[model samples]
Each structure stands twice: as C-alpha cells, then as structure tokens.
Target: MPSSLARCVLSCALSAAALAIPVMSAQSAAAEVVPMPPHEKTFASPDGPTFVVGSEGESINKVPPLNASGTVREVFISGSSYTRSDAPSGGTLAVGYHVGCAVELQGGNVGVGPNAYLNPGLLDQEDIGPVVSINVGPGSVSDVPLLTKEVVSGVPARIMMRDIHLVVNGCIGPAVVRQYTLMQLHTDSLDDIGVVYGDPLWI
Candidate 1:
C-alpha cells in the first residue's frame, strides 16, 4: 500500500507540472521584446540640397495600465539626419514620430482634433526635446517630436533616444508608429523643403 501511494503522488506531481507548462509559456510570450528593422530614406529638391535620414529601434509591449483598457509600450528610436548643399549654406532639420491607432496614417489622413494645440516653441528649439504627450483615442493620430536641430552642409546630426515609455490610454487595438525627417534648405536662390520617412511599425 505504501508503494502504491508513493506512485500515485508522483503521478499527480507530474500532471501538475505538465499543466503549468502552457501557462508559463503564455506569460513568457506576452513579455517578449522585439527588435524592429532599421529604415532609411533620402529626399532631394530640384537644384537644391539632398537630405538623408535613418532610424533603428526596438520595442516591447508591456502590461496595460491598472484598471485601464489600453496597452503600454516601451519604444526606442535612434535617428541620424544630414543635409548636403553646395550653395554655401545649410538648413534646419526636424525629426519626429507619427504615432497613430486604427487609422491609415500612410494615406495622409491625420486627424487632429480642433482643441488640440501643438507647441509652437518646439520649432524654435535647437535641441532634441520631448514633446507633450497627446492622448490618442481610437481612429486618431498624434505627432511626437523626439528632436530638432540645425544641420550644417555636408555635416550629419545624430539623435539617440531610448527608453521611451509611452502609456497609450483609451487606445484600443494595434498601434502604428513611424519616424519622419523634415529639412528646410536655404540656398542662394530657393528655400526648399525636403522630407524623408521611415518604415512604419505596428506595435
């Protein structure tokens, strides 16, 4: 009888261990971190300077906020942008991200509410600074600037950003985010604007 009872206990323990395996695997999959592929683009104006921009980053989907229905994501994007002009003068370059949810942002339909106010002072800043967080609802979009600075001709400006903790409240479903680089070249004859866009990532 003693040997029989020991065998029974051993069988129950193995059964419990087997049941726990799937749960553990599910939890591990939920916390997985993924590295996004690097993206780059180049834009040139007619008889003007050429602008090149690139971004490399990674992202992780974290647990949602307490008592909230949305998800929280940790994202990091590093961008390098430069301008080349032979007209003796360079231009200003601005780098930022276009974050959206459930909307086709690539179709050029970014809906900003009437009450939304974008800080004008961001344009005047010469350093990479954090922009104010915007609450994006379903089917909405927001622009988050990571950095902006002046770029000299034939010189490159590198902006490194990491550990960006974004709490997307009230946002349901998957979210999409992409980086944009805009440069304004001031030449002797024409002041032209060039833009480069990074590949979109679904987070």
Candidate 2:
C-alpha cells in the first residue's frame, strides 16, 4: 500500500473506534444497540442505497425507512444491523467503521441483519456456483459466493442479493492491485454490488 492509501485505511478504522464500546455475545439480542461507526459515506452512485463507509453514530439520512416498499441492499453485521432505537422502521444503522457492509433484502422482510440469522460471524455457504468478488474500496474480502432471495434491480454494481455470505476480513497484495483500485463484490444475481463468502484464512 502506498503512503496515501495506508493513511486512508487507518483513518477509516479511526471512525469506528467508539462502537468498540462493547460486543454483544448472545445468539439473539433483545434490546440491540446499533452502534454507529465514525465514518459515514456512500458509493459512487447516489440513487440506490447509500454505501455507508464507517457508521460511527446513528444514521444521518432517514429517507425510505427500513423494510419499506423498495428493496434495500447492505452488508449484514452479526450483532447489529441497519436499524435504529427499536422496531425495524425507526432508522437504519451500520457499524460505519472499517467500511460499512450490507445485505440485500426483498423489501418487506426487514428482519434483523445476518447477526439475527447466524451466530458465528463467518458463515460458509457451500456448493455455490463460483461467487464473483469485486472490491468497491479498501479492506474488503469478496470471498464467499451469494445469491439473492429477491430479484435485483438496476445496474450490476448497484444491485444487491440474498443467500450470500458477507465477509469483512480483507487482505491485499502488491501483485493483486496494480493501481488504486477499490474492491467490489458481484455475481449473476446482481451486477457491480455482488455478494460472495470469503475464507477465514483471509483474516
């Protein structure tokens, strides 16, 4: 990593330092606290769901509440996810720090994030057809392959999916990136915003 890129990565982590308040160690959370990351941001496009960098505090935008009519795409955080104070409709939350991750939802079923589904962070969805991993930014590991439970709309990068494993542990090498490239995850289900499960080894 160049001096400039390394600084960016460190700055990203700084945003989420507060959310480290504490870790939720239960299989399911009763009154979940959706901690915000220090960093807040969006992807290249502004139409689709915003790609929140590191959500340090609650959400800044309250538009299109959670589980609304239109579908929502976000990386699934185990303990907490895109939600506010209580109830799913309050507001959306993301860890903000270390880059905001997301999951693709079918619109109505806006249940808790993957942390609501599985306990162990890294779920290995097997027998996948070959998940395509693309980087949208720094510190992203597009390893696990995923499929959407709903039909993804819009262009490839903006599309989201279901039935895919969202991995966060990312590593980079001098050989892989020849330029200043951001990683993105994509597959047949969607275009640029692809979902793929990654390996623990990447950690």
Clashes of each: 0, 40
Model 2, residue 68: C-alpha shift (Å):
48
In terms of lDDT, the poorest run of 10 residues in model 1 is 104-113
Q: Point to the candidate with the largest lDDT.
A: 1
Candidate 2, residues 1-203, lDDT tens digits: the string is 56988998888787666444443322123223333233223343222332322211222111221232222222322211221111111111111112222322111111134324322222232223222222334433222212212222232211122222232222222112100112232332333331111111101
What count of clashes does model 1 give? 0
Scored by lDDT, model 2 comes in at 0.25
Model 1, residue 180: displacement in angstroms? 1.5
**Model 2, runs deviating above 4 Å:** 1-37, 45-50, 57-118, 122-203
lDDT of each: 0.57, 0.25
